[model samples]
Target: MSRPDPVFPFFLDHPARVTSDRLELLTALVNGPRFDPMFRGDLLVVPPDHPVYRWQCRVGGCERPGQHHVELCFQQDREWAEARASGGNQAEFLEAATRRQHAGWSRFPA
Candidate 1:
């Protein structure tokens, strides 16, 4: 008896079968209770305040997304650092920081 080829697997031989299996698996995953409702649709539009997917800056009126691990966006973070160095606190910074318009690329289409 001969062994099957490792490079060209039996599943790869049938494209339709593989596609169907993937669709079925995706459907089951989407239907699971643990799945987030925001991702169930064809277009994914996550809310800024989503607990697990928060992307926007937390400062009021700021339109940019947060940096990697911090809640403030890049510009806001820099501004905060400067203010803090000059003896300003978070509350004063939040009240004094200028509001920024959204970046061209960050805007979503209607």
Candidate 2:
């Protein structure tokens, strides 16, 4: 007898060799839908004149399809620090922290 594949075969930590439809279905099931901030292809990595930014997942480097980076706001700069750190996404601290650099979310590489 033949066996069926798992319903959700993709693991976030590992590379998934899944079809686009499968990935779309999974994303829709979970996050419903998300707007692509990288659509503009600007500041995808960071904003201009940013004091300091650290690239996350350095292991993946620029080669990764989706590069994650976050700005490093020092404690002394309370305004900027609080603004960046205010985001409630505890899962990815750096990811949330970097959001403060842009108006909303812009993927434009800068």
Among the numbered candidates, top lDDT falls to 1
RMSD of each: 5.2, 15.0
lDDT string, candidate 1, 1-110, tens digits: 99877755768778668778889999999999998887898999977766888887878888887886778888999999999999999998988888777787766455
lDDT of 1: 0.82
Q: lDDT per prediction?
A: 0.82, 0.39
On a 0 to 100 scale, what is the lDDT of residue 78 in model 2? 43
Which residue segments of model 1 deviate by more than 4 Å?
A: 1-26
Model 2 Cα shift for residue 26 (angstroms): 7.3
* Per-model TM values vs. the true structure: 0.64, 0.18
After superposition, the stretches of candidate 2 with alpha carbons farther than 4 Å from their true spots are 1-18, 26-36, 39-43, 48-110
The numbered model that scores best in TM-score is 1
- Point out the worst 10-residue segment of candidate 2 by lDDT: 57-66
